[model samples]
Target: MNSPMFTRTSQQESAIQTNKVLRNTYALLSMTLLWSALVAGVSMAMNLPRPNIIIMLVGFYGLLFLTEKNRNNSMGLVFTFLFTGFLGYTTGPLIGAYVSADMGDLVVTALGGTALSFLAASAYALTTKRDLSMLGGLMLSLFVVLVVGMVASIFFQSPVLSLALSSLFIVFSTMAILMTTQGIIRGGETNYISATITLYVSIYNLFISLLSILGIMNDD
Candidate 1:
């Protein structure tokens, strides 16, 4: 029963809303990335040890839960920063170890690779007309597999398993970036906070995965 004009107007409004969410998500993501980097630098300077795995899991999941619960409010931003800062603190010790061992170039290479991958994935997502929502279920399945593999690697302490996990992470993170960006554009995701968190986590995983792969290669 809607007129053509009305339908057009609705589409325009939807597009505007989508654009706004995308802009806000990217802006907040940039700030959080900078904040996380600063926290990591401080942790490195202090030579802070990485927290135990149990503590790391509790902190990460707890903060993530809080952020999702507060996604509609201003507190979401606070929790987002806390979540990212916590991750930065965890990463600092790893980076410090690499630097201490004269593997600083590996970190730089991983960082560059991560950035390039993100940009390429994002650009493709934005331009592609294909629906990416179908990827959601597959991504979830991959995530479960990833978690199991990570736990197995922890107990077995196998370099081969670790390397395989790292490669899988790279694939998973790239797909995540593409899927998240397309979800934002297609109106599947409306909350900028949630969108930003997804992208940030993807980027973080990409960097960590690349770093792990590079480190393994260097060791051989």
Candidate 2:
């Protein structure tokens, strides 16, 4: 019953809305990244110890849940910051250890690599015409495999496994960036908050994975 003009207008409106969400998501992502870095700097300056694993996991998942639960409200922003800040705090001790061990350059290298990977992935996603929504299932499968590997590595204490997992993480994180960005552009992701979280998590994992790989290589 809709006229051609009406359909065109609806498409235009949807495009505008998608653009707005993408812009907002990037803005919020930048702020959260800066905030997280600042918190990490403070933690490093104080030489804070890494938090216990159980507490860190609990806090992370709990805040993530709260953020998702409140995604439609202003409270989601609050929870988002809380979640990222906690991650930053946890990252500080790891960075500090590297610096204290005179491996600061390794950290810088990892940072640079992570940034480049993200930019490459995002640019590809933006420019490509191919549909990436099909990657959803693949990404989820890889994530589950990674989680299992991580848990097994923890118990097995195998450096080879650790290195392999880090490599896989890099691949997973890059695909995640591509998939999430394409989703935003394709109108599959309407919530800026959720999009920001996904992108932030991708970037965070990319950085950590790069750091781990670099550290391992440097030690060898």
Candidate 3:
């Protein structure tokens, strides 16, 4: 049964509303990226070190957790954007490498492709009637796999493993978007604002990972 919070008069109307959530999610995702880009530029200009970056991520996540824990307060969006900016600043290292002219085009291409792919996948999940709840378990399991793969990568250093992981990364990223969108449909995600922010962050990280894959594949 659909939660009355997100239920509509009919299935058609319910789908329409779900699409609205997706649309809102996409809109916020773009703005979040823009904010992140601006922060990246600043971090690079300031020559932030790895420790500083790590601190920023830790602090940013801490604040996000704190604010989200108190989300009933009026400062939720403020906290969200603040944490997003910090996340972008922390992302400086990944993007700072591409500050050179050579990888710029590839980065843009990868980012665009990732965004489009995520959008399409989320849209499919929204428009279709398929149940994606199973993906939740897959999402959790992927993290364990991802962590184990990272540990194994240190010793193996095999290109095959990296390639396989890249493929799995893309698959899991798409599934993240799919599950989030379906959560909206099933009334599993109650807070639209938080849902949109969570989805936006997932897609942003997906873009980063996709760019890394593309850059490595091209040996650039």
Best by lDDT: 1
Per-residue C-alpha lDDT of model 2 across residues 105-157, encoded as one tens digit per residue: 99999899989998999999999999988888988899899999989997998
Q: Point out the worst 10-residue segment of candidate 2 by lDDT.
A: 211-220
Can you write out model 3's per-residue Cα lDDT over 69-188, one digit (the tens) per residue? Answer: 755565776777777877777777667677554687777887798879987987798788988988889889997898799679879978778777777778887888888878887777
Clash number for model 1? 0
For every model shown, what is its TM-score relative to the native structure?
A: 0.97, 0.97, 0.78
After superposition, the stretches of candidate 2 with alpha carbons farther than 4 Å from their true spots are none
**Reference-based lDDT, each prediction:** 0.93, 0.93, 0.75
The predictions' CA RMSDs to the true structure, in order, are: 1.1, 1.1, 4.4
- Candidate 1, 91-173: lDDT as tens digits: 99999999999999999999999999999999999999998878889889988999999889878988899899999998898
Which model, 1 or 3, shows the larger lDDT? Answer: 1
Judged by lDDT against the true structure, how good is candidate 3? 0.75
Which candidate, 2 or 3, has the higher lDDT?
2
Off by over 4 Å in 1: none
